[model samples]
Target: MDLLILGIVVLIYFLLTGYVGYVAWRRTETSEDYMVADRKAHPYIMAMSYGATFISTAAIVGFGGMAGVFGMGILWLVFLNILVGIFIAFVFFGKRTRKMGHNMSALTFPEFIGRRFRSRFLQYFGGAIIFLGMPLYASVVLIGAARFLETTVKIDFGIAFILIALIVAVYVVMGGIKGVMYTDALQGTIMFLGMIFLVVSTYYILGGVVEAHQALTGISNLIPAEAKAVGATGWTSMPVYGSPYWWTLLSTIILGVGVGVLAQPQLIVRFMTVKSNRELNRGVLIGALFIFVMTWSAYVVGALSNVYFFRKAGMIAVEAAGGNADKTIPVFINSAMPEWFSYIFMLTLLSAAMSTLSSQFHVQGTSIGRDVYETIMRRKGDRSVLITRVGIIIAILIAVVLGYILPGSIIAQGTALFFGICAASFLSVYAAALFWKRATREGAIAGMVSGALVSLFWLLFEYKKTAMALGVTRVIFGGPVISSMPWPVVDPILVGVPVSALMLVVVSLMTEPPSREHLDKCFNGIKGV
Candidate 1:
């Protein structure tokens, strides 16, 4: 790749991004605009922004890398991303969340839930969870983009990390959600087009789709000894049932992110951005198509890259990337794609990273400024927004630091871990708040606290991936994990979400129900629905 061409392309992309951020900042004259795009976003922009934010570099570079290692079985997540993330999320959750948010005059997700349950504690607690927990997720996203830059352009990881982080922070701090969404719409379009080209180019290069898939299946005998020992059958098939690989794929990779998306604070807040159910209804089809194209192409191309690598270098994707699953996609693109196409794909990745990071930073900032600080201080106005700007900078710095410190093969693992934690901590309470009229403040608090604690404990002591990495369990128990085989492999969401739901139902039934008046206020116009 020519340095001049790359520099020119990057400059153009940055200028465009800067212009869009400026436009959004100009439009954002009030706190409402900053928080929720003044609750009047277009259907197309809302749908695109939601999909873009939902599918980030984590999906492309991170999970795509996993596909290279694990095979097409990870395609299950694409199904769930569309079904639950888009369909059920928009139809069942989005409409209700929008109405309830408006009814409560809630600006942030924590604020919405807080007002619903009438608890300052829930509000601040939820905020604290986001502020503390989101850095892991955000940092992995930074790593995904930075890793791509490192592979393709030979840029230093630290420099790439700061450049990506700084560009996103500036826009999000200035334009808020409006800025995030505006850029998201533009970025989403680039991602969609780039992915279309990628899949088409990949199949064309390797032969037709049928030939490519058949080639992958024929090489099943080449499965790594370690992978096969753990139940990896082939790239084309599912892992052996009840095997270690099955547990990781089904529990951690699939269900962890699949079911966990419903509870995402960043995504839930998108529901409240549009005007009404009409926007969400329209968003369903657009979001689904975008997700299908983006996820399907990435996973397919990732798995098939094995065929390309084996043919060229006589190695599988993971081996070719030096054992780092996170580097597989970047390495594949750098090696296989033409120089011209590489430039386009680089932009696709940048869009994916910036769109998602912008949302994460915005959520983290608001969680602190509005949910925690404002609620605790009984304050609101420009001071809170200023605080949010400060919070965004802090969040960016934290993510950059983690990007530097985290090890390789972590992109997918980090993404799943954070999603699982969010599922356990927020999914039960968030679901109850939206649909269960009987859910009470005390129940919400109990369920949230217990779920978060249980999930954390499991991650630190039982889950092999995290427990082993942290070494807390090793120090305390003289082993990698405290549990036996299947338990160690099982994702925390399996244990945490169930326990959380039980606590929510039992506590709500035992404690006094929320006041009839408060319930009425919450369910005001949507009672029949």
Candidate 2:
């Protein structure tokens, strides 16, 4: 009975999100509308879209899984999430992006940077990196949401992933950012409601908030020797200082997402959609409040799930879930919630995925359509728009296929890896473009190339399959094969982000700045003349 109700809820979510897509399609007058909603997004819509892009299934699902293993310390990421992601992004980056975007008349990130520095190479280079990198991130989010749906609804993983991807792709291709923003507003609402319910109901099921904490903390000794031998401690307790787990959390997961947000092409562009700094400022509180609740709840509840699993199954939940780090959050949700919640939970998961997926699909599609195929590839301007449409179709197909890749790049991702790469790779030039008056075209090129290549090089070397083939766990980091590190999860952001930033700053300093004339033109829109 409960399953049937949940199915209907899932059906309704698809219908509503699809409707937003339809609205975008019907209203769109040109390719510009399709790519950036003609750059007329209001304050409220922009804020929600920005929020949607930030908090996806990764936060609730991927991070939740991490919290299950790492405990509550991951909550510090929530603070960075809002401060850097919402406040700094909107206040600092958002204003400049919108102002300079208009000044340059640039529609995409690549175009914005390309036109700003008066270099087509930067445009193509930027687009190429985004095109190559975004799919991995989108795929990670896809897998996170799909895994949840497959478990809760008993749907096949392949079918669920493809269907969700198709639905989001259609809307994105049809409506562009306008469609994405509108849909994000709706999806963001669902995310808020769904996360709150999961948290509240879990608390109720555990008899109360106080009792849940007490139960989780009391079983300190239940932590396994394997866990203690490395870094695992009770969820209610902190990991040992300087432990591998702490470094991974502080450096990779936390720093990766927190610091990496400034460079995300898709999210960075949202700041350009709004009207003014006042609008961006208004969104700060709302964005922060929503993120705090959604993420904080997921981590706290994930930590407390050990108690729930212990009482019901006589073992820690991770043990019950087969010690697969990814399965921890799923086990908690399935074991803790009643069947009715699955229906709503499915909505939460889908909402999370679509919010991010739509942005990725659109950004990737437009890069092909507008940036590469048209601008750099030398297609005529009018013809390039047509190619962009075709590119959208192609990009969608690529994402759909990649959705089924099983995220083998690491233990699991679905799409999270791409986000890290995107942030680490692009955030530097992006930051320099806005904040540094001395940014140069030569510096931009070097920074982007160095940042992206260095990032991918690090990942390949660190997790080289050749090492695994030779009976080693890591190729570059080099250690034992069978034993776990104090930190089990290895995120790519920590390695990649700082290198990208360093490359950008150093290269910019080495080269002459963009001509003074260009700086004056770029800053023409600064308020009050």
Candidate 3:
């Protein structure tokens, strides 16, 4: 790689991104504009921004590498991402969220829920959860970007981490959601084009799509003994039923991320950014296609890299990257792709990373500042925006520090962990707040608290992977997990969401329903919707 050429290309990309941020910053005149883009974003910008923020470096680098290790079975997540994340989300959740948010004059997700239920407690609790849990997700995204730069550009990981964090933090602190979404549109375009080129070039390099699939399918014997023990089948097949691999893939990766996306603070807020259902309807096809190309291409190219690695080095993708699935895609690209293509792909990863990170930082900021601080202080104005800027900087610092501290091959695990927690803690209450007019504030509180507790308990005592990582169970119970086999492997979302939903429904029916006037206000303009 030519240092001067790389520098010039990166400089141009930064300048373009900075220009977009500057425009957004200039247009932002109030907290509403900063927090929700003034609720009048274009369909194209909303769709692309949502998709870009949804599919981050976590998808391409983290989960893409997991596809290399787990095989094409991980492709199921792509299907669910389109169906649940985009289709159901836009059609069911997005439209209602938009109307209700507007009705409540809510600028943030927590604020939406809070105002809907007439509970300041809900607002602050929700905001506190996002402020605390989001850093883990943000940190993994930072790691994915830093890892790519270190692998492809030979930049020091520390330097790359600081540069990426600083760039995203600056724009997010200044431009707010407007800045975040504008740059997301630009970054999303780069990611889409790059992934198209990646998948096409990968197939061309390996003979053809069919040949590549066949080549990958023929290497079942290459599965390591340990993997086979855990029910590894092949790159083309799903893991065997009841096996640890099966449990982790189905419950953790596929279901956790797929279902969890619906309640994501950063993503849910995108629905509030648009003005009406018309924009969301127009955005459906665009968001779905963007997610399909970005995710499908990553998984396909990731799985096929096995064939390339096996043929060239007599090793599978994971082995080629020395047992670190997180490095699989990076190693494959740098070693197999043309020199010029590597530069283009580098920007693709950077776009994916920055777009998502900006959203994360912005949401985290709003959670602590707009939701928590304003609710507590009983105030909202310029101070909310200023406090949000300070919160963004703090979020960036925590994420950068975690990016350095976390262990290797943690990209996918960390992503799944955070997504699962979000789904468990917020999904049930969020859904009820949107769709269930009979739901009481007490019920919502019960659901939220129960869901969060169950999720925290599962992470520390039942889910073996996270339990072992945190060492809470090990220290307290003298083992990594309290339960046996399947319970240890099962995801927190499975148990927590159900418990939460059950509590909400049962408690709501037993308690006094919300006032008719409040329900009328929330459902006003959402009757047919």
Candidate 4:
């Protein structure tokens, strides 16, 4: 009987989402509309869409579970999400991105960067990176949400993953950016309400926020010896500074995603969805508030779940979830919340996963079609959209295959890896393209290639996750690390981003400056009077 009711609710939600996608498809006449919604999105819609895409199943399920193991120190990411991701991104980067995108008459992010520097190679390279790298991240999102469905709904993980991907692909292929943002607005609202209830309910169950935190603090001595050796202090405190655990949290998890948000092609394209600076400004408060409620609540609830599990089951969240941090939040919700709320929150997790996956699929498709096929191969008109739709289908299949094969514990790490690579490869050049008049085509190419290759090399040889996964360290180095130093523990971003930025500056200084007409066109309406 309860399953029937839940089915009805899910059906209604899907019907509404489908209707929105249909409307968007009907409205999408030109390729521009398919790519950027004709650049006329409202402030609220744009803000909600951005928030939805940013806070994915990775944040709620993967990172939330991380909070269960690592504790409240993860809240630093919330600060960065607001300060850097929202404030700096929307105000500083977004304003310039919108003006520059308009000035260049570019539809895709790669196209914008390529046109700014007049480099076809740069454009094709960026598109190829997106095509090759994004599926791993998309797979993580799939696994996170599928794990939740398996836990709460009694569904098989593979079936849930494929079903979710297929449904999202249908809307994305048919509706494009318009369909994506419209559904994102709705999903974002559901996510906000669900997370708000989760936080409040968790506090109520634990007697209050103060009491819950106190209980967590009192359990410091319960830290596993293995965890403590690596720098875990307690669920309520930061890891020991400069410890391997601390490096993993700060450098890999927090810094990777925090700074990496700037270079996300899907998020950057949001700036071009609106017409004027006013829309961007109007979106700042909404985006900030949405991000805060969504992120803060998840972390708080995740950390508090340790208290709840210890009291009820005499086990910590990770132990209770069978040693998988990715399972902690799902286990906690099923055990802590009422049966009905579990079903409702399942929808919340679904919203998180689907919203993010849709955006990723859309971006991947456009990267192949608009950035590669149209811009690089010279395809045009309606055929471009057709190629994009085909690309969306192919991207979905790749993500599903990856989701099926990846280890269950890799959700959070996978998300961080993709974010780190994106930041290392793109952020430096992107900043230069928007703000530096001296940024030449040669300089941009050098920075991008060097940054991307360094990140890849570090991941293969030094970063433990990929190195160990690939057996490079064990097979080649005959050790856990290739270096005697703690390079294995540090994220590639810390090294790659700096090298990339330095290369951008040094190469630009050495190369000839861009033409006067090019600089004027790129900086028009953005430069100071």
Residue 270 lDDT in candidate 2: 84
lDDT of 3 by residue, 354-401 (tens): 999999999999999999999999997899899899999999999988
Candidates in order, TM-scores: namely 0.99, 0.91, 0.99, 0.99
For candidate 4, the C-alpha RMSD (Å) to the true structure equals: 1.0
Total clashing pairs in model 2: 12
Model with the higher lDDT, candidate 1 or 2: 1
Residues 1-529 of candidate 1 have per-residue lDDT tens digits of: 8999999999999999999999999999887888899999999999999999988999999999999978999999999999999999999889999999999999999999899999999999999999999999999999999999999999998899999999998999999999999999999999999999999999999999999999999999999999899999999999999999999999999999999999999999999998889899999999999999999999999999999999999999989999898899999998888998889999999999999999999999999999999999999897888888899999998988888889998888998989999999999999998889899898999899999999999999999988988999989989999878899999999999999999999999999988888988998888563
The better candidate by lDDT, 2 or 4, is: 4
For model 4, the stretches where C-alpha displacement exceeds 4 angstroms are: none
lDDT of 1: 0.93
- CA shift at 388, candidate 3, in angstroms? 0.7
**Ranking of all predicted structures according to lDDT, beginning with the best and ending with the worst:** 1, 3, 4, 2
- Candidate 1 runs further than 4 Å off: 527-529
Per-model root-mean-square deviation over C-alphas: 0.8, 3.3, 0.8, 1.0
Q: Where is model 3 more than 4 Å wrong at Cα?
A: none
